[model samples]
Target: MTDIPLEHVHVAPDDGADSEPAPAVFVLHGRGADEEDLLPVAAELPDELHVVSLRAPDPLQGGYTWYELDLSAGGLESSQPDAEDFRRSLDLIVESVDAAVDAYGLDADRIGLLGFSQGAITSLSLLLEEPDRYAWVVALHGYLAASYASLDPDGIESKPVFVGAGAGDRVIPESRTTAAVDRLEDVGADVASGSFPGGHGIGPQELEAVVEFVAARAV
Candidate 1:
């Protein structure tokens, strides 16, 4: 129903900023997942904020993938191509977000990005590449893609970043998450990292931390 295509349908909360200028949250899903996967998490956020869940452009065997993958690669190598594809998709999404902000009379400085797995990689990439784009960034169960080393730290505007990962994540090692947190911090981002007891998925504590981060930034 939103202006984006059916594949990009965003399940959002009804409430948003009461003032003419509102804050917005863009939700990106994990690999093999659709936009709907994070819609429920939006409900846990402050009701006064607008939430938009974006779908990946590439369709996988059954679900979806942000970009191609090569299993032969080690660590972050397997995610390089997909990360690049997500960067390209982000260009279009940022334009869409600009249009949405204008249409809803939302504050541009209040926009935020929330992502999981591959989506988290995209979110962090965007933040590092375009530091001023979002007020805050939330990355769950993902690490910084290899391409992150090329980013210029001075370009970042010191925005708040929330990195949450599981201690038992088999897909994404906890070491990778810690390395990412260190990278973002070194790049002048005010980052907060948390670890959950579960596997490679969101837990209640992580969700609560994210909600708190978004709510604090929305004010």
Candidate 2:
């Protein structure tokens, strides 16, 4: 059995660079989804990226989840992640991505992260908790978890980040996404953020922006 922490789909670069170790992008799916959900996004990325889409550990309602929701605050818009599960998922992803650097012959310094919904929340968490590990980040329809409310910004200076949210998002309100963007900027990260016209999903325009932002920096 493989030692990688999470279930994953790895797509090698279509037009690989003329080098031994390839750059990589880790794709994390939204809650109630599996590793396969975001493969199409990977296809649109630079051909030089070794894309790896991850499956969250906990299975839920015929799908998967990064962590259980803590909706004690009333509804989906006010929900938070269960702390224990969130931390565990973050640890597993960190381990898996680190291992992948060796297992897949990836360039460690060129690693990127992309996620949606719950996955997006986790992506932001990862970027904050271990900012030096990731070279770039794209988080969609997600917010900064409460646990990282006071992260030190010294390590992630000028880190590149892309955040997306739907103007009509009921699942994860655009306000939350904006808060995440604001925090990233406060921490001195170079962030590019936008709002779409749909509800809790990646529209074409947002998708194009994600593609462009990553393509420019991932190179």
Candidate 3:
């Protein structure tokens, strides 16, 4: 993955305000989806915001995946993200955020994150590592990875986070989803969670809630 360069798609406000940096949102797609997969969602954000979607480094099943899922022991076990690769990607993203703030003239303190599935997992991991970095986060159809258990909510500043799951999702079981939300809330994160009626995907209702969540962060 190191040999391959990181790729991304950037969408600036269409209101002819290209020269000034504005608020920003980082969009992350699910496993097997490319950077552009979430552009439509990005477009739904405030027009004064700059949006950027990033592609995962590793390739899988002809698409891209953030890491290798280790489901060997009957049920889902863990992920096999190359430690070095994961570290490098993390560093690059932190740098990217800083670069976006400068290059796009974004409000440095108002950056937010939106992600689905594996993308959501990555976003949450990043936030746990640096709680003060993002103003808010919207995670869809995903849970907090077990590896992040070492993160304590008491050690970090409070921040808003939205986690939406599918009530019928077997992929990420309800127990795991509930546990994730509980853990985040226990750690002092202002967590807002809900369940859509469907399964492992976001529907129109979830999108509406996500937009409202992000909008409220602007207040």
Candidate 4:
């Protein structure tokens, strides 16, 4: 079996115990950020969830990246991931999550995902690849990759997905975010999307909305 190489930070549920398994939300940060970058956001999440924030395996700009980005189709610095690296990273995450279930005694059926920017791209991609695997998802300021654009969605049910993007974001661009939302909805995923005013970062309203979104569904 391959090794799970991603580093992580796990926050136990507030009213949880070792004997009783709790639901979990695995968090993935944006490019150039680490496991701890999403701690504050994790703190604001529902207390019933055991939050596990993972560091991307590859390093970039003194931080971490899920995989090397492919800019060959260059137009405004497209953030499409290098296909092979992306696959490897996805395997790492899957292994790491399976291990977390064994190690932390988390509820496998209630696994959720949250991410921003490049991390969002990964999260959304994972959701598309395995619709029934995740209970819910939140992808911020990230778009769908062209790789999994044609997945068979007949197996997907009413999976809840919350998508947030800054109207002024230029890095990944708002249009890319909208495209992601459209794709998710097209695949029969229940998507809640909002375009806020900002640039490449989450605003107060976005945070509040995300917190509420998770709370309503936390197991």
lDDT of each: 0.77, 0.91, 0.76, 0.87
Tens-place lDDT digits, model 3, residues 1-219: 122245777777776645655678888888888888888777777777778787887787777877766555356523334456556667777777776676666787788888888878778888999887888888887777766856884435568999998889877765667777888888888898888888888788888888888878842
RMSD of 2: 1.3
- Name model 4 segments beyond 4 Å from true: 1-4
The sequence of per-residue lDDT tens digits that candidate 4 reaches over residues 44-123 is: 99888999898999889999989887888886447589999999988988888888888888899999999998889889
Query: Which candidate number maximizes TM-score?
Result: 2
TM-score ranking from best to worst?
A: 2, 4, 1, 3
Between the candidate structures 1 and 2, which one is better when assessed by TM-score? Answer: 2
For residues 22-107, could you state the per-residue lDDT of candidate 1 as single tens digits?
67788888888898888888778887677777777778866777777645576643446555665667776776677677655667
Candidate 1 shows a clash count of 0
lDDT value, residue 104 of candidate 2: 84
Question: For every model in order, what is the number of clashing pairs?
Answer: 0, 0, 2, 0
Of the two candidates 2 and 3, the one with more favorable lDDT, higher being better, is 2
TM-score of 1: 0.88
The local distance difference test score of model 4 is 0.87
CA lDDT of 68 in candidate 2? Answer: 94
Sorted by lDDT (best first), the order is: 2, 4, 1, 3
